[model samples]
Target: MRAIELKNVSKIYKNGVKALAGVSLTVKQGEFIAVMGQSGSGKSTLLQIAGLLDDCTSGQIIINGNGVSRLNKNVLADIRMKSLGFVFQSFHLDTHLKAYENIMVPMLINAEYKNKSAMKERAIQLAETVGLTNRIEHYPGELSGGEQQRVAIARALANNPDFILADEPTGNLDSKNEIIIFEELKRLSISGKGVLVVSHNDAVKDYADRVLTMKDGILEHTDEK
Candidate 1:
């Protein structure tokens, strides 16, 4: 089944800037896809639209068979909380919370997880998977950039989302840390969570099942090596 679908999607900012121009694409379940482009190519816009954080000016987005374009604000929020996970270039972990608490925030926000202890256990399991087992109790301030990013990834997976939208996920890391994050994302793809990433780094090419290039807000399929 297709995890994501876009039909003639376009985005025009309030300032008369066109971010996306008639973009169309489909991502299958568990596929690892990379969107590559230089700055200002609308990759970020596409990522936000795919993740339901933003809307398109014209067109339809069907995610997991649900039409996303017409959802009310509250419904969209619910869908975002349940179906989608996002990782930013800058690890957006809560500064005051420990890694475990940071990962639990999403569950708490959903308000349906009455079993606090179970959620805690889930958080611990995610931390372990992201290789942050020992740093579970550490606050964001205490960890290095890579460790913080791992925490962010763990938090993104807390809800067991169907897919993840990552924007420049490896851009903030050093070479060694970049490799670590790459491996973790690849592992997640193998385990069947579709990953859509926006990156300019050539290092991501080899890891992608398909690579798409964007120019002037238009996307083209690239021949993958």
Candidate 2:
């Protein structure tokens, strides 16, 4: 399935700074795509627009067949909750919540997981999948950076999203942990989920099925492993 399609997408700030300019990209199911660029290169902007966390200044965002560039905020929120998953450079976990509880957040908001007990069970399963089985009861601060990132990965998969959008997901990790995380994402893609990663980390190229380079707000074809 076509997970996401960005057609002539552009994003211009109010001050007239164009973060993205006529950028187009496509991500399909079971594909792992990596985007590389330096700071201020619009890599993050492209991710935000694609994930529906922000809107494009001009053009269309087709996510899983629905054009969402023009969708209302509520509709966009629904799509975000149901179809897309996100991981960030900073593991954005709630400080006080336990690892498994953090994973349950999305489930709580999702209509399908109305039963609290079932939601917790699913969260535990995700935690195990991310190698956090024993740490499921720990808080974010109690975990190491890698462990926290793993929890973040589990949380991202909580809603069983069609695509996972990761923005510099391994920016804070050590070399060893970076490999671990990248391998996990690669495995996720192999299992049929679309994974889009925007990172400057060289380690990512080894695991990506396709790598794209963004320069000065435009995406250019690039080499991959």
RMSD of each: 1.0, 0.9
Best by lDDT: 2
| Superposed Cα RMSD, model 2 | 0.9
lDDT of 2 at 205: 92
How many clashes in each structure?
0, 0
Off by over 4 Å in 2: none
Which portions of model 1 miss their true places by more than 4 Å?
A: none
* Model 1: residue 54 alpha-carbon error in angstroms: 0.8
Kindly state the number of residue pairs that clash in model 1. Answer: 0
lDDT of 1 by residue, 81-177 (tens): 9878889989999999999999999999987787999999999999999999899999999999899889989999988888888999988899888
TM-score, each model?
Answer: 0.97, 0.98
lDDT of 2: 0.92
